[model samples]
Target chain A: MQIVLAILVGGAFGFVLDRIGATNPNVITGMLTLRRLRLMKTILLAIGTGSILMFGGQMLGLVEVGHMSVKAAYIGVFIGGLLLGAGWAASGFCPGTGVCAAATGRRDALFFIAGGLLGAAAYMATYPAWKASGLLADIAGGKVTLGTVPGSAYAGIWAVSGDLLGIVLGLVFVLVAFVLPEGIGGGHVQEMPAE
Target chain B: MTLDWKLGGILLGAVFFAAVLLVKPIGVSTQFVILDGIVADAVSPDFITQTDEGWTSTNAYMAKSSGKYAASAAGPLNYGFVFVLAMAVGAFLSSMLRGGVPLAERRAPEIWRANFGDTPWRRYAVAFAGGFVVLYGARLAGGCTSGHMMSGMMQTALSGYIFAAGAFLAAVPTAMLIYKEG
Candidate 1:
């Protein structure tokens, strides 16, 4: 039933990642430094395409709004983002990519996965303590489900209309990928540390 | 036609099909369970705790994990963990089929050598530390790379946009530095 369809869908996603070298950390790392455009291009494409499908589906009533979880927490997000970003710069693979890379038998990816698990586990284990201590006890939303963080007016566009917003962002993502081939290529980006 | 898109459609399409054919959907929060199981076994006291009502715990387990499972993020049996595992399995199976396995790079550059130890153990340790910091941050941020960026943006999540900026800003530099050393 639904589960069956899910498996098929998942397999395809993984297949694409593998074929595109999404499972390769070298690609991710390269893309970040602006050396490789391959992996970034794939990511941009996924985002652009995914957004369009979601918007169109919702607009057509093909799916429920509830399916798209919109809840957001900025404080947790900000700190966590900083940490994850630094990690990516260091390790090259995000959580999902790292796991996939590990499966591909990449030694570094395995290490990344192992580290990811530990980090995630630690966060959860300490959540209760952090909550009780009031360290993160009062951290609340600076924005709503749609979220709001200054410096990005493009979001105001999204807020005006989900459908319009979806189309615009989706198109923009693709446009960026297309215009800056080097910025978002596949597994062979041009990045590397400046010696 | 974008080569990445065509390949993305076909490859991810395959992942999509395989997911439907195998077990459940793909996700990372779901992997919390496997992580829980492993960390629990690896570290004593296991985070999961059994109660009169059942188990009450954190993101993954002590077998006491709660909050959300696969079917939904709010309930039990969180299948999100399963998706992460499936991602791993699928990738593993594919590489195996291709006859290509993990290979260590012994020719790391001098810059990299300075930043990281020349040994595998040291390199893995640094990576582990990096993973730990990132995942810990991801949860605090209310999501991981997937949650805040891909899934978040798909939902038109403002948080996702902000998260993406932060991610790229930091990640891009790191990649460049490493690539240089390598």
Candidate 2:
């Protein structure tokens, strides 16, 4: 039953990702370089909306805090994130988007998938070294949240309510998405006359 | 035809929200590791073995979590792995339904072409390199964009915000450097 739900949910997730032009490398880079804000806006809006719904649902008791999974905090996580960002900017594809793109018959995505598998294998080979490096050691109390979430095991860095903070931040994201221009400076998108 | 950007964004949020509400957060990169384990196990019987307790792997990473990963690797039909495959299938279905990805989209993107060239191999190389870097970094971080940034942020995890900041700090500079024309 869970596996079946995974397929249905994963399918819907991929469908939306493709429909929003995320399957296109150009669209991704365009957003990264600030050449195209449409996709960026869409991404921000999606994140914001999802945040609102999720946090709101939690507040209303419709969502289970126990189901919320919090990743452990470590120095490697931040450094790894920076590396991931560089790759994202350069390749214009993240794991999920790359898979979606490959499915769309973008031949390049196949290579990306191969590379990702290799990368994963490489990490597996070096897992012990990384574990010994202390970079994986917990920091900021390991699994902590920005604000206190009732019924969750995580500690709050701040005493504020996490649900409220999420909703507020989500609203800010949506607002920014709506206000952001399509392009900046003399990019191609900016060359078009305003509506 | 593709959905409108605004509508698409809303729908994307809805899907993510539903998944989190119903079961668990959406994530993908970890499955890549699982795939690697599965392949390794298949090629070498000794790579993963069934213990009295459960499954165990010669590889320590897979052996962690009480051989939970090894179990998934041995079985290979779990929720997370299948979800990733389903994502690809969904993308294919959507593309076909839209009468196939336009030729321009199926190949190098405009920004890429403008910055680099139309050579397919070059683009493929870059794509592969990028994928490699991202996956490696994701493993180090213990999560990817979906797991750490998107879902983590939704859960208000401090690590999620930290990861997000680090990602953009590196990404913006990298993008600026690579696509000087754009």
Best candidate according to DockQ: 2
The sequence of per-residue lDDT tens digits that candidate 2 reaches over residues B24-109 is 88999999989999899879879989999999999998898899889989988898999899999888888777777656546766
What is the per-residue lDDT of model 1 for residues B22-96, given as tens digits with 9 covering 90 to 100?
442234643653455545544654344445655544343233224232124223333454456566766666656
Cα distance off (Å), candidate 1, residue A169 = 1.2
- Weakest 10 consecutive residues, lDDT, candidate 1 chain B? B67-76
Which ranges in model 1 have alpha carbons more than 4 Å from their true place? A1-6, A129-159, A183-195, B1-6, B9-26, B37-54, B58-66, B69-78, B97-119
Candidate 2 chain A: minimum summed lDDT over ten consecutive residues — where?
A186-195
Per-residue lDDT of candidate 2, residues A1-195 (tens digit)? 988988999999888888888887777777777777787777778888988999899999999877788999999999999989999998888899999999988888888889999998999899999999999999989999888877888898888998898899889878988999977654552211122
lDDT of 1 at B62: 35
**Pairs in steric clash, model 2:** none
Mind sharing the TM-score for model 1? 0.76
Best by TM-score: 2
